[model samples]
Target: MKNIKIKYATTFTIVVLMFANVSAQNKSELLLQSKISGVIKKMALEEKIAMLHGNALFSSGGVKRLNIPELTSDDGPLGVREEIKRFDWNSANWTTDSATFLPNGSAIAATWNPEMANKYGVVLGQEANARKKIVMLSPAFNICRMPLCGRTYEYYSEDPFLNAQLAVQSVKGIQSQHVAACIKHFAANNQEIDRGEINALIDQRALREIYLPAFKAAVQKGSAYTIMSAYNKVNGYWCSENDFLLNQVLKKEWGFKGIVMSDWGGTHHTAEAANNGLDIEMGSSGPYDQWYFAKPLLEAVKAGKVSEKMIDDKVRRILWVMYHTSMSTGHPAGSIATEAHGKAAYDIASESIVLLKNEGNLLPLKTDKIKSIAVIGDNAIRTFASGGYGAGVKARYEVTALAGIKARFGKTADIRFAQGYKANYKASNSDEQNAGYDKPDRVLIADAVALAKTADVAILCIGSNREYESEGHDRKSLELPFGEQALVNAVTAVNTNTIIVIMAGAPYDLNEIKKSCHAIVWSWFNGSEAGNALADMLAGDINPSGRLPFTFPATLHDSPAFALNTYPGKERTTEYKEGILVGYRWYDTKKIDPLYCFGYGLSYTRFTYSGISTDRKTYKTGDKIDVMFKVKNDGKIQGKETVQLYVSKVKSSVSRPEKELKAFKKVLIAPTKTATIRISINVNDLAYFSEKQNKWIVEPGDYKILAASSSKDIRQVAEIKVMR
Candidate 1:
């Protein structure tokens, strides 16, 4: 009782101080408010339409005779999309940055690494600041509804708890640099079919329970600075103008203070969009909005249908971001061509890769034993083939796998190359592969295998193309694109010493490769310097430190969430049966074994975990526990290991994931060196949504904390009781 009183008093005092300050600043707030009011007052129909007129990435009021400041904006979670000379918004120029895609949110959640996600944030922030972008349309927090559905690449795993935790960190990272991070696809944007017009028929419980929690987590913990509304309508209402979602749920309920922007070309009706909580209508020739806001909005205020306070609220939010983004001070985002910064982009790219399989010690090939090597695959030579979507900026130079390997080996190694597969095997970019970020396929994979037969080691690059694993669509299955699966089997059949490098952007099932191949390396679209990064890692010049971002299901059938979809459901649609059991959670909860569970990855070397610690006999409200562990890289090369942590809700009233990732930390240790990792978990970390309590309530009973190198590999467990 006493503690609660103290807390309430402190909060009350703070609120009082804030209210008083606002009241005192009424004159200043009023002056700023009047600035908006004058614009509202004079907004004639034509002048209003002019206000809605947009530059490619921002907006301006063409009442230029009356001196109007242009409102500036930019591209999403990555950075600014400036229309530079030769940089046309209509035509993409390949641009590579220090930015690397952290596994989709789902895969990131599987790692359960908050600190690591925060590190990703730091890297993102540095790049966003460097690029002078005001808003990043990233840290996508949409719920994964069904499998066989495209665009899952844009979301984290299906679990809301996991998604929320990682998103908070990513958001914090971008904001740390000044620009706002957008947690997007507001309300259920589960599928991409007719995305702009699809109605997300959602029930309130589903919204509050599954789709909304991730947003709640980010808003509450990370203080996400911006939200991008989805293209779809929820419960028959457009996301941009959905009052229940934007105003009532996001603002009134969650206290979200960030700006709300429409997904590019997502806004439908201009007046309704602005009338709701939307602050900016992104990426449109929005003259309609200018007229709507100027004349209609002014009328709304005059007729008392809406308050001027709302307009001031929207514009104030925009100004707050503009002043904070501070575009003037930082160096302008330069072209990667002829620049030193481009080197850093490749460095980060190399570091982001996670090695999934190494069998029969096929990796770190002996430099001397390799008399001949065969590099075969369509993506092996195609620049920007693996890297897809968004801004596909071409480089002044590109390093192909064949070229990089040859350069690395020089006189010591004789390397032969073949087009293992055509990036577009169909000879046309019209099939499923060609339509998305598709690469040519293995119509010529046979010849590559022919070369594979005589070589001491045949490196087979078979996985996905840009069309299959990009921002516009989600992969239909966890299998490698085209007939790459068959190519892997056939190549390995002809040549036993084949090393398959899966150049993909998402987790793919490789049961055949896993069984037959000597080794497998997962390269999630390594950018401009992809070839060099792979060569360096393969040559032992750099240790492979990337970890799996998402789970590699044994088979598409093993995926619990999607299996229930019954695609083209009985009603000729789908079902989200296993609601929250997305990714490995479903497998773990139901005790199904996946081909490769979440957090599954291997290092060139090896690691062992020991010495787990948590200094507590019991946890109560406001309690925190410190956990310490040791990771020893027992291999010949010095390596970095990510210590993953997970928490489980025991005996929940509602069914729950067996374990939920709460925290994670990354530590680098020299070969034969033991590094200690200390991770802290708050009592709230073990909390669960209690149906009885109707809130996210922490149960006062027992808790188990597990420390492991990966999800399935639990190295230690400690038991603690929570007291009320």
Candidate 2:
């Protein structure tokens, strides 16, 4: 009787789950039918309006009668943010909330590998699911418009094509786990200086081509289910209430089917933001009732200022997202910071470490070649897991560069440590910007130089701290802060064979030590395994294959945005006077040289590009062109190569960049082996945003297709005629 009862219970449980699955599918279909409409009709006016604003700091109201759960969201584009208090921004102090700190957004972009980005999303999605979050506010698609933008570490690349491709992959990975990926800071949230009030006065063409492409792709290709409105204003209106951006471009033109949620404290008006297309308002200060979309929205609906249909539409979209993700369907519970997630993070960091300069093969330091290795700088021992009131994750563990090197060669090599310079860039109560070590620390610099003089090779680990690069404020300049420049120069003077490992997100002026330093490596603020990954590359356990996602201008003024006075506008509004010329495009077009070009990285092993071929000499619209090239790993080691395909119009009526990246492929080849890479690009990719027609138009003309390793390193060129 007991055995029979257990058997029956097991059978009953399976049947119930099966029924639930079927019900979920039917409910999803019903959402598209009159059932959702009927459910909305039954909801009271106040309840309907309540669903549009946050009931807590990270969640919105749900209709209990309809069995819709509150929309649970988590902060961040990199990893799941640390758990917060129920009704406030304070930490919840939950041990389970600790996550696998993957490489920062800039580090991921440096990898130039979309497959890794997909894996990045998968792990992030799993973590979010583990935390019971229906939506992961991630896969931030904001372009790297300026190096000084405080949140540069959170964004991807300068180029729209590269940013779009990686963003799409990340979105696909997140949504695959039945979690909504919220592409954030929608539409020209570029700078952090007066972010809430600054108006980005951009023209339609520049907006379509540069600032908006990644978000567009996140919706169309990634199938992202949610978007977050930026805090800043676009043109003349806030992003939360800008109909031209939210309605005209995002929804109607690009066919974005997601719900648009306002950033924390981002919504200002109830009726205007609601009617414009904001589906949810999140994170207003004080009590929930004080939110812009709370009592004000309820009053608006009661007074007939905002339509009932608008409320219904908002609720419908929110339900649609929940139905697709956590609400209707059941997801397998996942664990945070699993071993697999750790490996993925390590792999991404390993690939993303860029070897900017390795003169005399100074890197891959043969463990046996050196006796005493001097590791100097405060960054060598710092953990970059969380910082600066931005999106951050509390990692279970973080590997600092010093720890990693010691773990790798501690047994065979004697590693000497020196503080070098104190990194005091942490924001303060009195003065957030200039509080830290902005000037040279002579005492610390003297100690570091003395230590360097006694070592075989001095490794100077220096770069920006969290305060200098975090969200909420723009950097004062692109210069290295906290006495890093003086420290590096002093240390290098003592030891000419100094190796510089810069831990920074955006580009910095390397002109100080570029000529004197024997080698330089850019190790972005990679997550938990950051130190271990750096050790692997320095010890030659893995080859360096990362590339710069943005150009390192010789000076800040070399950047078109700064050079043309387009950034940090006057009278609360800034014009994109430089237009579409950004990053490498500006450098290439104006003949202004950059310290390091975009897509520039050096590997331990060398690779050669040859056998460039095109599918056909001529093509028309709606056609595909296959650009084939063979990459040979000429060195005596296995390596990967990023084949970048760029296209330029031979002659055009409208102003355009010298060349734009259309397609790219990352491939690995064994030693002395050649791999043929075929990158297919649609003829439509040649289209430029036309102001006259207010649409993307492909002009009939001859185009030059170039293959290159970096923007400045063109390996091959071919001409193709477009007869439209």
Candidate 3:
């Protein structure tokens, strides 16, 4: 009795301390709010209005009298963009502005590691600070709705769960450095075609399950300080002025405290945007004061079209963000393009190179035996640090594939290169923009074939570049552009020891290559150290561990959007006909096999799965399901494996996907060693958003937990019952 009483007393003391901490935090927040209110009251209507609009290309106005600094921003889904002229898109010509270019979004997602995402964010945030900027417009994580979405490289994965995981960590990582991470493209904004005008009509359930989770997680869990409204419309309403999305969903429902800024020239009306939830207007055209949120907003307030209270609220939010960023205490002095930042880029790029195929044990090239290496294809010499559309980094330096190879193999083997095909792509308004690009050059092919014939091994570097897989326009098809197919055929015919390395950001038609090529590697528009990372992987300095973030369809017609004829829709509007069944969900449920399934990647080593078990057979709401399994490395080298956990509901009353990803972990294991792994999932996460009830509902039923290497590679399964 005495012991039990002491335990109860101890629990009570801990609870009291927790409540006290919460109370103190609440007091601090209230104080901050009071201070913000004081500042807003002293500001004139014109000053308050100015705070809501751009004073420069990448910055908003601030009251100099009040000592408030303008909130500066930088374009950052890949890395901090080069400093541009204050009034135009021209470069500022600052030699010190070069930064370390981190891997793109899809490449980061390919690792399927949230920890890596956090590291990516830290690099971005630190660089933003180094540039003396407050906001980093980054970590764009729109769902990969289609393989040819143009910005697929800039986005994350097809799975909402994966996107949410990465988004949360990315946000936390960025904000940790006292720089705000502006998670972007607020709603759908999935396609680049007619992006500013097209309306996306999506059902509530689909929005909840497939589209909105990442943004929601970034706001509530990651505590992101800013969000950027997309250029497109969601359900007939422009995202910048959408009452339901910006006001109802983001601010009220999810309790987001950040400011909502518009995409470049994305604002439409002054009153509508101000009355809605938009806090800042950026990238709009015309005079700085004439922008929608500038002089127009002040006039709107004066005319009683938009309330003064709304303007004050917008200013308050802006100041709140400022206090957290530029005005924050003890902010770290950040460094840019440092050696450590370069290593971070290298680490992400190294883990991101996915090995698609390694037939005949041809990888981990026998460096000791090779005398000469023939590196072919334009990608070998191409620099991806800058070019194309959207955001491009002014990389301090970018190591090309050929450069990386020579650095790694110069002492061991003789290396030669031939530009197998011309990129031939230049962003323009002419007819040649997307035309006359794929035809292979016979002369270049002949040179490549001759080099391959004389070399002991040939590395054929081929695939899309920044210009081909850019942001302004989607690819017409998935075929290898720039006559790459013809180049591959010509080179491989002469050299049977050819290894194909695909340097691209999105999926392409690889059906032909999969059959013809004995080895294949998928590399992205990786950042500064792209070549170094690729060289290290090829030389077995580090094993390839990246998995496909989206399913690679066998054909364009096989994808859900194309199969249902709903993509790019009709009459300036598109319906999400595929609904919640996206990516692997669609393929798995429809029983269509993808060229490469989501979470699929190959390694030089092999792993075996066994001993799957759960802590309990029954779960209730709020319960955590603990899953345990064993993975044994069965190869001669060390490697990392991503363990994927998927859940399926048996005999559901409502329609559901075949299975949904619930949890995943990336584990590194030494050769011939066994490692026990445990992952836990919250029961609340299994709940589905019910449109009829307008709430999440967890149905009582039998759930099958599948442990797998990839979506289609289930290794073990355990059954559990959920009780209401």
Candidate 4:
């Protein structure tokens, strides 16, 4: 056995030296270049085809003779998914696989800080690298089209520019760690209803402006190494085999040199998929051998139906990913969930907690004044590590909100707890299951009210669970699931000094709760240190700095999709008829008042904005306009403020949004001190996608640059002229 091990190691060293010699000879080593071609030409036809499909549940095969190692693709965006067995979905049951869960996508986006996004990506990438994963299947960039979209928590925001900016930074950070960041769910995969079969019909302009910008940024700016095609169809073709989407738009136009892999069981046809830009087919219907890229592809190539060149190209891209990531980079593998990562998770959650309403200054609660406090709700004491039937990390430890609260105030104050409602973890499988899941129970409500009556102040934690907001299905409505509103009403009736903390993944109806509660905070499904972060904010240890990444519409009818009859479309086909008008664009254009505007958040301290000016009053194409603004922390507390800059065309021939976010900056200021922030906008930022011309058009006109705290609250405006 020892002699055999020595011989195998010796062989591996020789192959490694050969690859290094080829790479050194061709210093450029571009994708599909001489170094990759040399290896491909030597590969047998069967071996090349084998590299194009899953050899294991979450991995693909590699040619051992060529020294190419199997690529271990792990689910991420938050953290690495727990290890699973090679042939099945069963856990590998490894003792050291517990990872640190970072903040969810929306929660990180809420920070409105690109630097923090980069840090989040770095931690995730480091953990993935330590786990020996070459590709971290994450940084999902799907636009949040509807609040009820079950997978909204996994996405960034409705605004394309904001999403694009953050995605670029995240991709950069991940790649910096030598792990390929796979930006996923390409095209208009905005909803989860019938995800595998739904045909998304979107206009070309909307596709460019609203849905595809982030992917574009990931490719052009971030230089992402891999992309995962959405399960749904963009127009009529399945995303995995959509010729125009994958070949024309993604590959040719955007210059995406990365490999395109199908989502699990997302591929349908063999010839169409190979002919299109799909480089790999993950899993398909039935058995592993029946995958579209396996036997079918082999038969096609042998019969001259599909050329051997197509199989070679696929193998080339696969080899490219391996060469670029840790497989060839020699990043060592080990455990990496350190105390610093935990602090980073807690910091991100603290910055993401949005203070929606703080009427009469009820927040930043003084713990000394309150002798007894009631923490009533399901989420307050529950652990939120993983959810739904999708990718999730098995965290080493999770801090519940109740636990964090006790750790913070348990010594000084009497902390009381009661289960207000039972939050169901299991998602509904049928209509009967959904009905029973949503049914209300009077006993839980009575117990909560009794606890609230005795306490001086009640912190009502209420919102949807994994069942109501997760992958595999779309939510029916924005209402809180499981009779949470009834519980809130009953508790608030007993104690008027109640604070509401929404522990949901997305926005929900807050009209009734907003009226009764003294304070309201939107805390997303934060990561492993969620409770500790929430406790810090409540105890005045850290001031909240998060902003709403997407607009919270007043009602479902007010949404662009619902008003335009587009979402949850009939007959498996959904229309993005709302076009460029999504989220805040819809509300601003329709003159509708949303419950909260985009980029809206309240800090413990007050900020005063002034001295908004631009370096140039008129600018031509390619010119950069530097907008300078002064943000002063007027209140007594130290806090961070995000300065937003929006641009609007004065009078354009084509219809346009009222204003779109162009640039932003987050700055920390001392009490009574002012910070001068300078944000520059490129001339190309003024360009709008012109469908008639099939290109971006920078119309020569006067434009207004508005500096603001939120979308609606414009503080200062400067007029600028764009010359041809």
The best candidate by TM-score is 3
Q: Which prediction has more favorable lDDT, 1 or 4?
A: 4
Model 4 lDDT per residue over 1-724, tens place: 9999999999999977867777653545643377789898898998898888888878887889878888779899769889988787788899888899888889989999988788888888888888988888889979999888878888999999999989999999888888899999887788888888899998888988889889999999999999999999988999999998899999999988779999998988999999998988887234666788988989989999889988887787777777778456456453467788898888889889999989988889898898889999988987667777657888988898899989998988899899888875476467665556665678998998999999988988888655567788877887777888889888888898899988877888888877778899888889989998888898889899999999888898999889988778889999888889999999998899998899999999999989888998899999999999889999999999988999999988888999999998889999999998899999887888988899998899999999999999999899999998
**Models sorted by lDDT, best on top:** 3, 2, 4, 1
Query: In model 3, where is the ten-residue run with the lowest total lDDT?
Result: 426-435
Per-residue lDDT over 659-719 for candidate 3, one digit per residue giving the tens place of the 0 to 100 score = 9999999999999999999999999999999999999999999999999999999999999
lDDT of each: 0.65, 0.87, 0.92, 0.86
Model 2 lDDT, residue 458, Cα: 87
Over 34-111, each residue of candidate 1 has an lDDT whose tens digit, in order, gives: 565676566444444344424444443445554444544444332233334321345333354333323334334434
Better of 3 and 4 by TM-score: 3
Q: Quick one: RMSD of model 1?
A: 6.6
Task: Point to the candidate with the largest lDDT.
Answer: 3
Candidate 2 stretches greater than 4 Å from native: 1-35, 428-436
Judge candidate 3 at residue 618 and give its lDDT. Answer: 99
